[model samples]
Target: AAAVAGMRDNNAILSSRDWARRDVLMQTKCAPLPREEGRPAPRPLNLVQAATVASHAWPPQSTCETLGLTALCDTVRSVAVNREVIAAVSNKNIFHMLQLYVNGIKAAGIKNSMVVALDDETAAWLKVRDVANYVKVLRSRTGDTGNHATSGLKFKVLIDFLSVGCSV
Candidate 1:
């Protein structure tokens, strides 16, 4: 196949591991490093750098605050979150980074319920909702072309179901 041959031709420029590491939040050389003093190493930081830091901090919420993210997590009639949302993300391994989104939040009892869990930061992010209340599940980048937007798919309810599955 041309695609396979092209990949072989460009092997010198590509690392097979790159395909696996793409989704990872890699630390930059300028970022903090471990120190013998039992503290994080001093490193350059900026706004974008701060965002990168926040997502991996001990508690994700603190990271969001560190970056001064304007997304307010609050109660609304409905909210949308990318499936990657997590309340307390943990990296067990390269492939085991837990996505904290609403489901994990509920599982952790961080909030009484997902619908009511949106706080000041997450609320501000609702504008870019992925599913926007569920009528139609967010379509895959490659899926059916029905283009039919169904009605009445509740995200909170679905999140609850997902939570239930995890408990089992």
Candidate 2:
């Protein structure tokens, strides 16, 4: 991605006919310059470093790698859990990561029901259930509120997915 961004930037510079900037670009080790009839030989650059700098350029445009990942990630985005929530849980121990995951869900406005199915009666029942008490304790210990423990009932898409299953 970085390399591609650099290549684009270099192309931009070339299109502008900024020959005076060529020395500055060379010092900064951007992409290889096109051969000019009277110009000296162009030197090789560390594309890896150039790429890192290119990623931070203003008015960023999507590259093939980013588009490819987006295409592949559509399936993952369709999952029940938020990717950020999953990332918190998967990257750390479940016990330690639970708070972060809960916080992420809350921050993203993802309802609990979106994570798993549960009606009001079931949610109420689960609140008192032994397993649920453990979650309550975990929440209390982690300084979280009831919001993290209850089911999310408002995500119509999740409901649709549940009702329609693979057909969705």
Each candidate's TM vs. the true structure? Answer: 0.18, 0.18
Candidate 1 lands at a TM-score of: 0.18
Tell me model 2's lDDT, rounded to 2 decimals: 0.31
Q: For model 1, how does the per-residue alpha-carbon lDDT over 1-168 read when each residue is reduced to its tens digit?
A: 122212333224655665632222132312222344555666633222223332223124443355332132211112222212222211112112122454334343332222211223323333243212111123324543222211122343344323311110
- Runs in model 2 deviating more than 4 A are 1-93, 112-168
* Candidate 2 per-residue lDDT over residues 1-168, each given as its tens digit: 133323434344354655655445445443344565676776643231133323223112243134333321333334323122121111111323444545445454443222221333333433343111111112233443344432222243232232221112
lDDT of candidate 1? 0.28
Worst 10 residues of 2 by lDDT: 130-139
- Give the deviation of candidate 2 from the true structure as CA RMSD: 20.5
